[model samples]
Target: MSTLQQLLREIDAKQKRINKQRPLEQTKIKNLKDYFKVGLTYASNALEGSSLTEIETKVVLEDGIAVGGKSLKDHLDAIGHGRAFDWMWELAKGVAISEEDVKKMHVLCFQPSEGEQAGEYRHVNVVITGSQHNDRLPSHEEVPALMNAWAVGLPEKRKNRHPVQYAAQLHQEFIVIHPFADGNGRVARLLLNHALISQGYPPVIISPVFKHEYIQALEQSHTKPENFTAYIAEQALQAQRDYIRLLRIE
Candidate 1:
């Protein structure tokens, strides 16, 4: 097996053990797990060159209905129109970005015309506004090149950083760059999970239940490295806990 495949198998084994311990309803848990897996799969596949529109069409709509017939970008926006609310909802339920949110995330990740929308805070040079750190705002010209550079740079960074920290760093950098006119927060979270899943870590859910803490942790990324790292680490440990609970393993 390829290294990536082997690592995933190990992650699955770990997740299974965690799942066994939780007292969640079997059917509900199964559905939730399926949705989660589908969401992650969609993300990885898209990054691997799957068509975004095709992936969105397959994952977002329920009961065989097309929401929009636009290009991939437009379709993403149509699907993700109300993603901020959805993101908070999923986080409340101990899930991170869902397949639905992933579609939205794809739409809002990085737009080419966000030079003004992405105002840069002079303090730390990371892209966030007061009390709400969204995505990085780049010059329209800068967005495409940055993403291309990131695509090349991310793998090495992922390997070197602790999985949780790596995930947070990606999240931070995404926001710092503010690549989109909108959807920066949601996309950043999605990128965070992609980092984890790629490395065989369970999806780290930023529970909206912990929104206060979540925002606080992100805010600290400006000057407090340890604080930021701790926040992501705490979330990672929770995913490990939840997985262990679900699988009922020692």
Candidate 2:
């Protein structure tokens, strides 16, 4: 088997172990959700160049205290992402993803600051700053049809692959579509977690520390899909380990 496949198996084994510990207590679930809300909001926003530290993110979301020197846009990103994270949980309880659900998450992530463009697709063409790949995103005119096909095909995609692989593919595909003008990266991560959580796995946080490797893997995805899938599998495994240790599951 390939390295990516092996990593996927390891992730699957860890997820099975986590599954055996569930129907986790309600309080435990609440605590986990609260913890991840801050961590993920921080990491996801930071990857997109938000200046909010994890502590600041927690303070902003929990204490509602604005940090001095941080841009208003940065504060709004954290708050908007927090709301998007909560909406993710609600979507996780559903049977399948929809285009409307995806747009709603984007709206939540951007509405706090960019209210008008909240969930709207960009009318202009864009470029990824450091990518080696030259693939062009679908034009704005193409987004609605492309996204509809993406949402409609998800069930079939999930059936033939491991959940982590499915999530990774979904994420990569969403980025390729670049459906929204901004917040595509944040929405993509939220969508990825939605798939994983729906499958009974803990949500993975791709730390800012891995930002270069993460972007590079994505840049090389067309030529080397395993690199991207393996990166995601590694993060998923780490998430599972963290969850297991935090809950003290025997």
Candidate 3:
């Protein structure tokens, strides 16, 4: 078996153990969700260059307080991402991901701040700063068809691939498309977790501290897709461990 296959098996075993403890107490579930929302919001925004610290993100998200000296855009990013995180839970309960649901996540992540472009694909081209791939993203006119095809084909993809690999492919493909005018990374992360959560797996958090390595994996993906797939599987395994620890399950 390949490394990806081994990782998938490990994650599946852990998930089976987790499932036995399902229907976690309301209080425990609430606490875990609250903790992860703050962590995920902070990390996802930070990966995209938001200035809010984890503590500040928690304050801004939980208390609605503006941080001193922080850019208003940063605050909005936190608020918007937090809302999107909540919406992700609702989306998680769905049977499959849809193009409309993906657009709704972009809207939740970028609205008010980017009202005109929120939930909308870019009309102009953009480039990733440090990527070595250099391939042009699908143009504005092409996004609708590309996205529709992606959504329609997801069932077959899920059926053929392990959930971990499927989640990684979902993220990789979405980022490659770079559909929205902005907030694509945040939406992509949300979608990644959406795929995992929909399948009874806990969401993974990609720390900003690993931003360099994360970009490297994404860049290498163009040549060796397994590199990125393995990276995502590792992160999923870490999340499984974290979930087990959080529930104090042996």
| Top candidate by lDDT | 3
lDDT, candidate 2, equals 0.89
Give the Cα error of residue 86 in candidate 1, in Å: 16
TM-score of each: 0.53, 0.96, 0.96
Evaluated at residue 31, the lDDT of candidate 3 is 85
Deviation in Å, model 2, residue 89 alpha carbon: 0.8
* Tens digit of per-residue lDDT, candidate 2, span 1-250: 9888888888878877888887988898898899999999999999999999999999999999999999999999999999999999888986488888888899988885886888887877777776666456677889888998999999999998889999999999998888888889999999999999998889999999999889888887767777888889988989989998988878
In candidate 3, what are the lDDT values of residues 108-226, reduced to their tens digit?
88889997888887888777787766565777788888999988989999999988999999999988888887888899999999999889888999999999988899888878888
Q: 196 in model 2: Cα distance from truth in Å?
A: 0.4
Better of 1 and 2 by lDDT: 2
Error of 2 at 143 (Å): 1.7
Models ranked on lDDT: 3, 2, 1
Model 3, CA-based lDDT = 0.90
Off by over 4 Å in 1: 1-32, 35-105, 108-141
